[model samples]
Target: MRKFAMYGKFKAHPGKGEALAEILLEAAEQCKSVEGCDLYIINVSEDDPDTIWVTELWNDLEAHDASLRNEDAIAMIQRAKPLIAGVEPIKLKPLGGKGF
Candidate 1:
């Protein structure tokens, strides 16, 4: 089956980047207990302190979609919403990689 992946950037409001990243990290931990979740990574760059990058890998598109509706996931989203200024998401089809 083809894996589903998403590379997204979350722009935090003003100086809320670190706070937003922390929330996302919590979400990453929550994903560990979710079925079909392969990876959920939170990243930051010194060059962009107000931006948080997230990488997610799922068993398939359906699994990814279901995860969005997961209770923990929904709570995390709510917590992060106030800090988020904008979001940019890039969908990808995983072919091959070290993590794959």
Candidate 2:
């Protein structure tokens, strides 16, 4: 299966970083049960508390779509509406592994 990844800069509202992180982490856990989710993670910037990022891997584009349609995802996004300032993610398609 082809690997799909998403990398992004999520700017959080003032005093909402921790709360947004919580929702992201929760979604990560919830996504494991998703049909095609391989990996989901959230990373924070130590130098910038208002910044956060995510790395997600899915089996395919279809799976990625399903993950986005999941109830948990919808819920999480809703919960995060007030906590986020801006979300701009860049999606990637993996070409090959280390030996490629």
Candidate 3:
């Protein structure tokens, strides 16, 4: 099966960037043990502290979708909801890369 990838940006409420990032980091850790989770990276931007970027790779699209429905993921989303001002997700078809 082809891999599934997503690049997303989460904008946090005023002064809540750090908190939001922390929560996302927790989610990353949880992904480590999840089936088909290849990568879950959290990044911070120096120019925009309120913007948290996530890069995810899964074994397939179904795996990525299932991860979203995982109980832990659901809880984390709820925890993050209040702090999230906006979200931008860009799905990608990764042809080839050093990381793959």
Q: Write out the backbone clash pairs for model 2.
A: none
Candidates 2 and 3 compared by lDDT, better number: 3
lDDT of each: 0.91, 0.82, 0.93
lDDT of 3 by residue, 1-100 (tens): 9998999899999899999999999999999899898899999887899999999988899999998899999999999999999999999987878988
How far residue 38's Cα lies from its native spot in candidate 3, in Å, is: 1.0
On the 0 to 100 scale, the lDDT of residue 17 in model 2 is: 85
The prediction achieving the highest TM-score against the true structure is 3
Q: Order the candidates by TM-score, highest first.
A: 3, 1, 2
Q: Once superposed on the true structure, which residue ranges of model 1 sit more than 4 Å away at CA?
A: none
lDDT, candidate 3, residue 24?
Answer: 97
Please rank every candidate by lDDT, starting with the best.
Answer: 3, 1, 2
- lDDT against true structure, model 2: 0.82
Residue 45, candidate 3: C-alpha displacement in angstroms: 1.5
List the candidates' TM-scores in order: 0.94, 0.87, 0.96
Kindly provide the TM-score of model 1 when superposed on the true structure, using C-alpha atoms: 0.94
- In terms of lDDT, model 3 sits at 0.93
